[model samples]
Target chain A: MAVLEVRGLEVRYPRASAPALRGIDLSLDRERLVVVGANGSGKTTLVRTVLGLVRPSAGWVRFDGRDVRTISGETGVSTNLAEVYRLISLPVRDLVEIVARLKGGDPAELEARLREFELGEVLGRRLFELSTGEQKIVGDLFAVSFGPRLVLLDEPFDNVDFSRRRRFVRLIRELRADLLLNTHELELIAQLDGWRLALMFEGRFLGPFAAADLDRLYLTRGTRADALAVMETSLGTFSVTRDSGDRPVKSATSLNALVESLA
Target chain B: MNLWRPYTKAMLANGSLWFWAFAFMAFWLAVGAFVESSGVGPGRSAVVAYTTSWYAVIVLLSLSMLAVAIANSLTYGSSALAYAFRFSRLTPEGYFGSIVGGSAVMGAALSFVLLGATAGMFGGRFRLLLLPADPAGLLAVSLLGGVFFMALAVTMILLVINYLGLKSTNFTGFLPLVLSITLGNAQIYLALPSWFVYGSPFNDLASLLYQGYAGTPATVELGAASVALTWEYLVVGILVWTAVLGASSLVLLRQIRSRQLEEGRQI
Candidate 1:
């Protein structure tokens, strides 16, 4: 069975005229799924919906075969404490201890996991004191700890240094579970193997393309500037540029295009 | 050791818990000193002690106010409660345990501290009882009465917290706690104010404490059923409040958990 499945999910903010996500359908068993879109293209919203942080105005979220609602039954952490659990910036120790208790992990095993993350010493410190890279490590560690068959990572690389980003890419390789991550960091795409890419525009999730297709998607823009412009307007924007040798480089035309492609 | 590990960890992990415990102890110490110093002499000390006990009453009243605010905040997501949700993994039961346990431990610690201070002030031969304080006798009655009041106070706070929701944070969760404290304090002077007393546990506690404090001789005049001062009363009262707060917190936690799940799924 697919470890995680989402179908026709839609999210609308309280007063917004437009929906955040209109009809997002996706599935994964154990492979890594990277969502690339522009800002506000619904990447984060999609992840949030899957994580059960946002309620869907429409559609269903399923982990394994169970509905997301059933996973959070009568006996569990309430919404009040949910925000606390989402605090990735907390010290590695505190986060692991909390996740250990939440997932009902054996204390010894939790300790082992902490050591594995090279965070045994760091755990004793406050979460806010950790470096940005350390904080991301803690976040990834927690997401991987509970054997969550399907994990949603929203903008996992935001504010992370390139070196740490590479480290996180290595960590992602070591992760033995399925992942659905949202980010615009293309560097990650170059490093991680066996991951599918989902392009997003406005509120739509475009192709779940292969790496070669993504390379072509990057290349074809130069050959078809008019098509790129049309796609950019619908998708948001497109820009053409050149290298030191004056080679035509077709890229994002505006911030909107960049955010949409990243989202 | 592992069994006590959670308690020790709790005490150490959250300095505020220890702070509340010690703060209560200091409060009781002050009350004891005030009572001893105000003595007009000999047998009439009872009257003086009675009046001076009002200091302790104020402390208890403040605690009630705090309880009310805490309950409301817990139910409503007031400041401290909101912080608790953010920093602590406290399930409803955990939250309740922390508050009630901290309160009682502080209350009892303060009681003893006050007693010691009072003895020191008198400078006479003070009878130090090595035996456990009577939990089932007169002291039990007093403590039980206290617990009844505390429970009612806690419930009132919880109800407000639950109903107030996000608005509970406006006053940093102090509003509900203060409101409870004020209302509970007002009850002391109102001679069983019609609204709070008829069906409330505090009514029973008020009569119980009066009887317990007054002793065996006054017991008959105070009521039909007489219970002696025993150590069990303190133990039992502590246990009862612990249980009550715990149960209520659990219920609240479940509600919060479900809401978060809906949120996560929405994510």
Candidate 2:
């Protein structure tokens, strides 16, 4: 049975000419799914919509076959988005305790998990006082500490150090929950082998292929008159663009390089 | 999880809130008491009237400040209410109940402080005004009044966020204080009709506070002539307002759908 489902999801900001997400359809059961996209490509918006933070302009989201709005708190949905910590002035310990109590998890166990991550020193410090890397680490730990049925991580490795990033990869591999992670780092795909991959560009999704095939994927100038960039994947070729221009074809494997070439 | 414990601790830990809640008002109250004591004779009607008026203002100001605090806690970016609603087992009604209950407790505690300060400063000089005629009634009114203001503030904040799409605290933050001073206490300054005075929640709250403190009908100065509001009229007005505001707050809490709050737009 599918644990989470989103159908025809579309989100538009007030006064914005373009939609942030358009016709986004997804279904996740027990498999780990990774969405790779550039900044402003609707990855964060999708995560937030799934968490019920943003209302969809069209369609609906459901968890365990029920509408997301009908369910109360502690529905086993967790995310590592640092925006959740913005403007929160409480100490990390208080935050952990609050979350643990709210989710019906053991506080002592959460504290132990913090210590395991070498984050015991942050217990006394307020969330806003921590560095960006530290905040990401705390957010990541909180998302996984509780026994969540579904976990969503948006750019979890953005500001983290190399050693902590390696540790987080191990943590992701060890997680028992179904995962939906979005990132632009192509190198992470090889590490997370066997996971499903989707490429997001301009509010649409492409290529639900194996993460191992990321090395074979490359972006080049499109042959079609209206297409801006064309993604050649092992599954098929997909193109989504509004601009029509003649530019040098730049073959790139990573999202950053592809975005740079597009720019 | 016990929500009150953490909520109360957070409220108590706010230094600026304490300054506004107790220290700032207490300073003005002490000064008023000292000046009034030196000028007026003991057991004078003028003293009772002055004390009642000052007490009403203090109650209004303190509760308004509390309303703003409660509003911020519920709607600000990364607010506890938002986080709990998203991740915890907390329902809208549960969160609303905890906030109102917490505000009532704080309101009752503050009433004691105000009453204690008034009695200590004036009791030495005026033996007749040693204490309120009904101390328990004053406490009850304070608690109920706190709940009313909190409900009103929360409903208004949520309404603005939902309809106007405005989530900035700078825009809607001081709404309670502004409303309390102008509309909430309009009866004190303007000559309102008998029906208006009896129907308006703000007027009712002011009347209740005045009557509770002085143990008599509250006299509303309407230009040259004044109207005395009876206890029956004030009680009915407050209860009706409380019920209406409470229901409105619950409805608005369940309807809040602003995406800006989660995006960190509140300043």
Model 1 CA deviation exceeding 4 Å by range: A73-95, A106-118, A218-255, A258-263, B1-8, B11-13, B17-165, B170-172, B175-190, B193-198, B201-251, B257-267
lDDT by residue for model 1 (B165-186), tens: 3333345335434543454345
Report the lDDT tens digits of candidate 1 across residue range A1-263.
Answer: 77778899998987888888888888887687877776777886776566555679999987666776445321122211123344222344555655565555545665675576556876677655767666665555555554444556777777666665666678667867677777765545656677887766667776576633344454223224333222343533443222221112124442354544533
Q: CAPRI band of model 2?
A: acceptable
**Residue A49 lDDT in candidate 1:** 67
Interface RMSD of each: 9.2, 3.1
- TM per candidate comes to 0.67, 0.86
When just chain B is superposed on the true chain B, each candidate scores a TM-score of 0.47, 0.83
Clashing pairs in 2: none
Predicted model with the maximum DockQ? 2
lDDT of 2 by residue, A1-263 (tens): 58999899999988987888888889999989999888888899999888777778997988888787666676488788766544234688887777777788887887887798788999999887899998888888878877988899988898888888889889889989999999877777789977998888777777676777665554444445444345543234445343223322123455545645554
Give the least accurate 10-residue stretch of model 1 chain A, judged by summed lDDT: A73-82
lDDT per residue as tens, model 2, B186-251: 665567776777787767777777787788877766558877887788788888888888999888
